[model samples]
Target: MLLCWLLFIPFIGGLACWFVSRRNPDSNAARWIALASMALVFLPALSLWFGGDFSLPSHLSASPDWNRELSVPWIQQFGIAFHLGLDGLSLIMVMLASVLGMLAIAASWSSVRSRVGLFHANLLWTLGGVIGIFLAIDLFLYFFFWELMLIPMYFLIALWGHEEYDRGAHMRAAIKFFIYTQTSGLLMLAAILGLVFAYYSETGILTFDYNQLLGAHVSGTFGFVLMLGFFIAFAVKLPSVPFHGWLADTQANSPSSGAADLSGILVKTAAYGLLRFTLPLFPEASAQFAPFAIALGLISIYYGAVMAFAQNDMKRLISYSSISHMGFVMIGLYAGTFLALQGVIVQVVASAISTAALFILAGQLYERMGTRDMRQLGGLFGRLGALPGFALIFVVASLGMPATANFIGEFLILFGAFSVMPWVVVVASGGMILAAVYALYLMHRVYWGTPQGQETIARMRAREYAIMMALVVITLIVGLFPNTVLSVTQGTMNDISHWFAAGVIAASQAS
Candidate 1:
């Protein structure tokens, strides 16, 4: 009941804020209501770190059951359940969602003036859906939350995006984002139903509890196709290459808060889904497709960096940076090593922080300077030293600079890849160089390149400095002591590695 409460509280708060803010938008109640609600939501997520079983089961230390699972029947007829669970792999994602959800609300301060209630409604619901994604263990529940996130996000962009982006443009961007993810999201649902039906037919029992479905072996093309369905769904969200068209629209034009959430948290759900479901559920197919997936990952890194180098708009550049970082996450996933899996987790967290921080900086700039065009936005490093300095940290981190959190993740990912596919590792290394190119280019162009004729909004305010500093500290602390994360993550990664190893051994024996 308590775990479920933690999941639903944000949603309940959203609905309450909607009504209350509508009645009294003039008062601080609306903001406080939204803020307090989100803060409360953060508590339970953090509690999991200290309270739950955090160890691999000794009997199967290599493949322990994920900790603190909560399950109950919801739709028995379809084999669905009100199933929610977490292990080391998921708890970190949950914590990330909670922390960022609050930050999204904080970033909106003073930026969102019109339709305040409605905007908070969209924002809070977005967080709620994200929380749902982190908690849901049932396929149906997962898909339910997956689609549930779209509506609020769509409204966030179309209604609150910059006035300069005309209605048609905003509508087009919103619709494109919705259509792409929604269409692919359904394909994943179909795949889930197919897997469940197959399991029922074989065992005379039915369930979509992820635990039950684990290690449900299949052979031939069916296994491969099922894996494709899961991969495409996750990829659309990861927005890998051809699947990436939707990301820039959402990130570039969205309201600051929307952009923050999109970059900070929403994109993460897809990466989280890939690690939690796609690879583990269909290990053989994932392994089979490793080479092609690694190729896509490498391309995303170089391509995203190159594209960012060419961009004039700062927001769009950050969006491409996300594409590059997420690409590495995919690389980590397919690399299939314990260290690599942990790297994926670290990459997701680090990338989300850096990208989110970049956007928040963009929002602050937009609020002050009235534009995001990097060409018109120079001399900032001189006038707004602190702000540029903060931006530089996130920028360097995004570039995977050593002593930042991003470096640790990228290091493990490349090292892990070298073990299995040395050539792929070499190709991926180019992305690191490309990252430096873009990161430096962005720094030179926006902060130090040339001024836009005036030093409007010359410096960052305390609020802006505070938020950016918080993110900086998170990156540095984690960067310096990655072991804090690596310790908790090792227990889970070992289990996943054990499972994949079992499957691999089976394949080798049959050979």
Candidate 2:
């Protein structure tokens, strides 16, 4: 029941915001309503985190032990159910979404003045869709939420995005994002249907229930093909390497809040999908494909870092840097060790915080400076009170500075994976050096050089200060005491690792 509320509150609040805005376009009612709605969702998730029992059972099983679950028949003719479940993995994701959603609203409070109500409605709806993606247990429901999130995001980018010289650039970026994600999403849909039909042929039952389908005897070429479909979808969403063309443009053009969501929350959904569905559903195929996935991860890491180093646009730089960060997540996902998997969880949460903070900071810088090009702005460290210092902290965090969450995540990933894939870990380590170069280059170009203009920039506002401080605190706490995050996600990560290992063993024996 609470899971349903968590999923529905943002949606209901979005509609309410739209209606409230229609009635009072000039008032702050819509913003407050959206904030309250997120608060409503966040409090429950926080309670679950504190109060829920997430300890790993002494005896592990093929099936996961969900802390909470709800299932109600929906589309009975097609064997679909309105299924929702929460484990530690999902609890953390939802909480992240809630926290980021609220901050995104605060970040946009001043900049988005035209359609205040509609802007927030889209924001809340996009978040609602993301939460739905995290919670949905039925494949059909998952796909539904997956597509649901994209439309509002399109609106977000197209409607409120930053317009440089060309007005249509944002729209083009939005459409490109939609087409890439939607087309890949369709492939996943086809794969889902193919799996369902395959199961139906064997058991005369047509169902999209994740638990039931998990036992579906899928293997051989058919299984691998289905897995590819799902993998491509997630990769595109993950925006890995070749499939990542849409991300830089989209992030560069999107409104700051939209970029934060894109970088922080939306991309994590791909990692989640890989963990929750792709590996678990077609473990053998995933294992077979692990080498290729790791190779792509390597490519994305180096490619993103190189591209970021070459970028003058601050947003594009951050976007490419995110690609590099997610590459670590990709490697962690496929490493198939308990430690590597735990690192994936931490990296996902930590990267989301640090990256989102940077995007928000970039947005703030743009608001005051009237540009995102690093070449156009310099000597900001002394001019912008507190903002530059905050940027420096997050920038260093992005490069996996010691005592930060990024370091813990990357260290665990590399160390854990080295035991399994020493050569791959060794090669990936070069990315750390490249990351430092680009991160520092970003600070130097934007903050340490001669002043491009002598204009007096406004100091950080109260809201901006609060948001940055909160994010900084989160990054440090998670960095210093990752156990807080590790403890909650350990059980889920362990279960996933076990499931994948069993599949690996089965595949090996069969081979």
Candidate 3:
């Protein structure tokens, strides 16, 4: 019911936007229609968060359980169902998705004048698919939405992106994105089917339901292999080191809104999958894999920070910064403690908003100066009025400044991870230094030295101001009162943490 409508509104509205465009090409009608659609989607997400019992009750089983669910048989012969569920974890994610979706639309309004309808149609569709990802409880259904989301994003980059001063820049980036994600998706699909068949062999029940499959016994070498499949898929999506080739290129070329969705929400899905599926689905394998995973998190942190410092392109710099921020998130996830997990959730939201605001700022700079090369940007700080100051605040926030959400998240992640992997946390903390170096360097190059661009600088418009300020307010709220998110997600994090603990115990007993 409520869950179904959440998915329905954005998808249908996407089509409506296309139709609106068809009727009147080059009109603002399509933009408003798309905005309205995103608005409609937000209402339901709000209701679900405020109106539902988000906590995972103590009486629930060892498996992570949903607080509210709706199911209808879809492929009975194969035991597939159109299952949708919501818990505190997903409730917060859905709400973030909707809020960012609207802001992305607002950010795009003036920049996408040529193909307003098509641009927004893709936007809404991408948001719809993301929402579906958050809600789908059936593995088959989840994979469907997962792949579904990427298509519209391909169109977004291919059609509206800025990489091409030449003919095929956007196409190259889009193709690379498609190939990378699609290949990873195939690997994930193989693993999902592997799990299903594994369960069927043990109990003679063919099912793709998350809860049912969770109860199936999966361990040993074969279980480890399947877990690797799932982990690789999530890691690539997380764009962990050695597998992050596509991220910088895609974000560098993408339109502001596309980059926003990519940095803010799309990447966050990888973290969600790790939390919701990777650890819980194969806890023993995940626990066994923690040390290596923590090492990789440390690598991503320094790697991203170093690359961001070296980059001249604004979008690429921000993309790499995202990699650095997600590194902390990765550490929290693998730490497998309540405090660390709590930090993971907070960091996810905070990082998304901060990165999104930067992308939006990049777009604004392009609109004024017509280039994102930091070499060509300097001393426009005074010329652009408060934009320089705004950029300063966001840059500081990106570096995990106190009273901002990133600080709270990074602090908790370090605090919790220290208990389990003291040496790793100690090494990873060096990334914060790198973060400050690049962040301040970015600000200095773009705003302090001298106005290097040939074009005139412009002040922030009402629309742009609104978009940035809204993100600013959200980040401040999360930073000032993280308890709102922590309280909502506590029960579920407890369940997930406990599940990993149980897995470790069970593995020890078996050994």
Q: Which predicted model would earn the best lDDT?
A: 2
Counting clashing residue pairs in each candidate, in order, gives: 1, 0, 0
For TM-score, the strongest prediction is: 2
Residue-level lDDT of model 3, residues 114-215, one tens digit each, is 778888889899999999999998999999999999999999999998953556787899999999999999989999999999999999999999989888
Evaluated at residue 116, the lDDT of candidate 3 is 80
lDDT of all the models against the reference?
0.82, 0.93, 0.89
Between prediction 1 and prediction 2, the one with superior lDDT is 2
Q: List, residue by residue over 454-491, the lDDT tens digit for candidate 2.
A: 76579999999999999999999989999988999888
Q: After superposition, how far is residue 173 of candidate 2 from its true place, in Å?
A: 0.4
lDDT of 1 by residue, 145-213 (tens): 999999999999888887553556777789899999899988998899888887888787788878778
lDDT, candidate 3, residue 503? 74
Give the CA lDDT, 0 to 100, for residue 197 in model 2.
98
- Locate the minimum summed-lDDT window of 10 residues in model 3: 56-65
lDDT of 1 at 385: 52
Full-model lDDT, candidate 2 = 0.93
